[model samples]
Target: MNLHGWIIYNGNLPGNKFLDFAQWIQAAATRKNSTTTIYKNNELLSYLGIGQLEVLRQDKNKLPDYVVFADKDIYLAKQLEYLGVPVFNSAEAIDISDDKIATYQRLAVKNLPIPRTIIAPKIFVSGQLDKTTVQLAMESLGFPMIIKESFGSFGEQVYLIYTEEELYKMVESLQGKAFMFQEFISSSYGNDLRLQVVGDEVVAAMKRSASDDFRANVTAGGTMTAYKPTQQEEKLAIAATQAIGADFAGIDLLFGPNNSPIVCEINSNAHIRNMFDCTNINVADYIIGYILNRLN
Candidate 1:
């Protein structure tokens, strides 16, 4: 059986951490008696002769059983799908999971409680930002709201707005970008859960808190501590991951008023950090194993 894992990225490998993960996968696959491939070209297919690349133009007689696209680009994922290789989580699923608005809408429709959200157009028309419309949305869901660009990762584009003035400033600053505005949930415990899901199962989970900052992402200097998941939180994490049809994911969950658990966001291509120390699960190995399982 032949299985190929593709590391598609836009630039130089971000850090040694990525390379470390790749090395771990390499070792794991070797032990399993499987072949693994890494394609590191970041330039566009046309610029770099993607037609000549084995992934783009597969050898009809030697097609790979599974292909994993690790890049943040959706276009490349779609191109691979067109070539008939069964990609993990497929291009369509990646496209949906990457967008914040779509992620919330899909989860909410499934009866999964998500914070109240509103999507504003990329370029606001003359009447698009009527005061009454904004007021009504804010009335039911009050201050200290969150606003985020449609596609961002590692807590880079998330914003916390506390007052009307700040909201206007944010809207004006982000006038020409796709954004999602939502009410913020103040966790009574002052921490949020990070659940890593692999193919419909919650493999590793942790609680992260930025005691000094509002964002709970470790990249933003948050402290990641071991968290024990309640039976309900574990089930919710699995359901949310499956709802988006993600084979491997990082689901952000929060506890709102009355201790109601809510899903904040679903992540594609999640980086595993502090996960191994807390859970000792070898999340990267599990992710690679899932891909191999589908191929077998």
Candidate 2:
């Protein structure tokens, strides 16, 4: 448990949440009698064109025994992995989780439960969609559909389309970007479950519910309440995490009919601040413990 680790997070993001994640992990590692270094994603200069496997000019620093990657910088994650350092959640898992389209495809391939999703075709320009394609998505998903931009977080780019006009507008705005259409889980209108999965176990679980919007993100006015997950919920969450090749993730579950749980989304490097505040269970400890268990 005395291994040295690095916690990497996006420094460009305009909030304290990212830093808070890194600091919490650092603290947890300290508690475990381990040393940690926190680095912003940008601070590490990834050597690509220079034909080097290392990053940054400060190569004098010893390579970390393990890395807690909390950023979407896949190149940096992969570079560190290429050097044989263990990165929790892995680069591939983070890539798949960052793209909703890829995430659903992986889950479906594994025969896991997920909401019905239809991915929009790739486009280079923003404009009106061809009637045929729009009609297909509409007929397949129907009204009150969920249009989620492939690369977004915290439900900011996810929309609840209630009519044709709204759908078209949302689609037009996202025409050139990667997005998907999903059948709305009316049963989970404003409520969802978040199971923080660490190394095949559901360490902490919470129910997030919003009164104003369909999104159950705490930043979107959703309130988090500590909740115990059922056997089925835990199973699906653990399976979904593995489906994306992740050892750790925050798995969001939607309430499906007949008391079933559906995979809504996965956060490979899910922030633990909110969960810690809500559940009083620090996943940072779980993460450090999990990493130490694996490394040692």
Candidate 3:
């Protein structure tokens, strides 16, 4: 495959993890005989006008056949798409995956198994929180529920509220930000399944458990173990990936009643390093292969 591609990640984030993702994808592309260039999101200036769309990239390095978008910069990704470059996972997928409210809405529209959720209305300031909304969610989800901001990663913005006061405080504090109230799945306390799906198949998976936290994200001090997903798990994960219109994704599943699988979340740009460390599976290879095949 003599394909040329670009791997783009966020440059402002103060971590090598984003670069690691871009580099991993680059190496995988290289092994397949594809040439790739890694660029930060800030490197390319997206310009838009009436009947015009272009990025102020260097004239020497032309755009590639495709782009491996590893950042949450949906606007930049959409600009690339507008210029007719096929972007794996696509901008729309990333946009939906980045918003928990949108993710749940997509999942619910598919009639997928998700925890009962109520979206908090977005208010402009800190003091404008509607207690009626809180009352409704409290009545619906009950105590010890979960409150998650619509846009957060690694379990940092998720809260487990055991009382109405904490719930109100948390919800009010997230002014101007989208968030939701969810019924906590007690059966899956401290643990969940992360299935890496490439295209239409589940390629790798691991069980993540935290000793002291409700979230099972690896970035939140969660431990991992290789997991063999049940047929139900694989099917649900694949359906979720498709539901979000992603070429590939990492689907988090919570164990529901009687060990049933519930959709916890879907990560469009999920880092593969942790999954690889746990399962020794290089999901980048699968992603590159999938993109090449799609391009072909």
Top candidate (TM-score):
3
The C-alpha stretches of model 3 lying farther than 4 A from their native spots are none
Model 2 residue 202 CA deviation in Å: 0.4
Local distance difference test, per candidate? 0.73, 0.91, 0.93
Which candidate, 1 or 2, has the higher TM-score? 2
For all candidates, the clash counts are 0, 0, 0
- Model 2 Cα lDDT, one tens digit per residue, 38-88: 999888876766556777746569789999999999999999999899998
Question: For model 3, what is the error of residue 288's alpha carbon versus the real structure, in angstroms, after optimal superposition?
Answer: 0.3
Consecutive 10-residue window with the lowest summed lDDT within model 3 = 122-131
Worst 10 residues of 1 by lDDT: 53-62
RMSD of 3: 1.2
Q: Model 3, 1-296: lDDT tens per residue?
A: 48899999999999799999999999999989999999999999999889877888775588899999999999999999989999987999999999989999999999999999998876765557777888999988898999988998887888899998888778767888888899999999999999999999999999999999888888989999999999999999999999999999999999999999999999999999999999999999999999999999
Weakest ten-residue segment in model 2 by summed lDDT:
50-59
Relative to the true structure, candidate 2 reaches a TM of 0.96
RMSD of each: 3.5, 1.4, 1.2
What pairs collide in candidate 2?
none
